[model samples]
Target chain A: MMVMTQENLTSKERFDKIFEVEFLPQIDALYTFAYHLTYNEDDANDLVQETYLKAYRFIEKYIEGTNAKAWLFKILKNAFINQYRKKSKAPTKVDYEEIINFHDEENDTNYSTHTDLREEMFQSMMGDEVTNAINALPVDFRVVILLCDIEGFTYEEISKIIDVPIGTVRSRLHRARNMLKGQLKTYAESLGFKDKRSKD
Target chain B: DYQELVRKVTMYLDNELSEAEAYLKVLSQEKSFREFIKSKLHRRKPSPALIKSIKDKIKT
Candidate 1:
């Protein structure tokens, strides 16, 4: 892949080069993120298309050969908040940040005794159990878990992508994992899998 | 202390922490922790048609 200087590249060439090289490769990831956000195939496709169109319109703002995935993700996330959430009339998110600040004990006391998610159970488990559990979470927590645990974005990158502080990302991730564990535990018990926390 | 350990373990798995980060060393030695890190949720892939649509949208 040839790296083109922004100055030398014409408008068409720059859009083509960046769109093909930097943006298109991220299509699947952007789609997946969009799907998780919208929970509908058509809506996800629209969100991704809007993101790409928006990315092209603002192409000069993008630095070539940089973190294009994060850049695209930020655009998609903002589009979801600004457009989809409003269009759907989604309920306003209560400020988890305020609760997270004053309610520190809830974080430690509730989760301290919990064991890590057992791999053996999840191994035997099949289908959309994991995906369903993730989807069941609130959008804020869901995004962190997807970005960190599933997509493997760094905390710094996730913070920037979601436009939140890194500490908020960490706290949301921690809380999200705990919530996911509770949900999965219920699911495993329903499937006759034993809780091995006491044994471990 | 337990909450701190969980934080470290999550950070360690996410590669946000250094290898020699304290407490993570012991947790990393556990089999459950190792396998848990490898477990992932299923991700939806964009349909081929969707992919083509984006490419066409960008080209024109």
Candidate 2:
């Protein structure tokens, strides 16, 4: 594994400095994204480790002072997708339009099955209910919401990270957020959030 | 029709052409949904031990 040594970031101390200064600050956010993708603490930690490992191994290729968070996220997402493909028993491509059509035909209000979300749930809703909802989405939809809504990446940036056209990103985000709207509405209605929210 | 028309107008004015329909549809759904998603799921702080573990992995 021969790595190119660029001029400025060539020295050992300089390389360490680049890793610490650029990548370390993004560890928390990277961990959150990893956890959401894997939904397991150990697996999430492993994914983050792999991301940094790859980042360091190819640091010479990384341009200085660019969007490092997005770069790291792109690596993490690619790793997760590769593993997800291995684990999934379904067909290789989890086509977004197909999934959307399937659910729309079933009139499925719920996407992910973590539906223990009740009205009292909203009273303490600052926590797992949101995660449950996000975790339930199919990976295509989930990544769009995660990258766009959660991570605050622009559609163009997310398109590049996720390696899809911007049009695909737009449609996926629309569908994903719409699916969440239905799922969260069920929880909100049960938790009296709708009524309480309206009065406020 | 009229409300959607108003919404399309607003969206067009904002140059969010792609989101006009989705935005209008979402309005009929939940008003505070975006805020809820953004605020609650902003970013969870990783455990202190995990932070140390990452630093160890990267440093050593």
The DockQ values of the predictions, listed in order, are 0.39, 0.27
lDDT of 2 by residue, A28-146 (tens): 88988988777677788888888888898888788878988989999999999888888786666787998888777566556334234544564554356777788889999998888
True contacts kept of each: 0.56, 0.47
Tell me the tens digit of each residue's lDDT in model 1 across A130-200. Answer: 66777789989988877876577899999999999999999998898778777777666676655454212
The number of the candidate with the highest TM-score is 1
Clashing pairs in 1: none
Candidate 2 chain B: worst 10 consecutive residues by lDDT? Answer: B6-15
Question: Which prediction has the highest lDDT against the true structure?
Answer: 1
lDDT of 2 at A55: 90
* Stretches > 4 Å off in candidate 1: A1-9, A88-127, A189-194, A198-200, B19-40
How much DockQ does model 2 earn? 0.27
Q: Give the CAPRI class of candidate 1.
A: acceptable
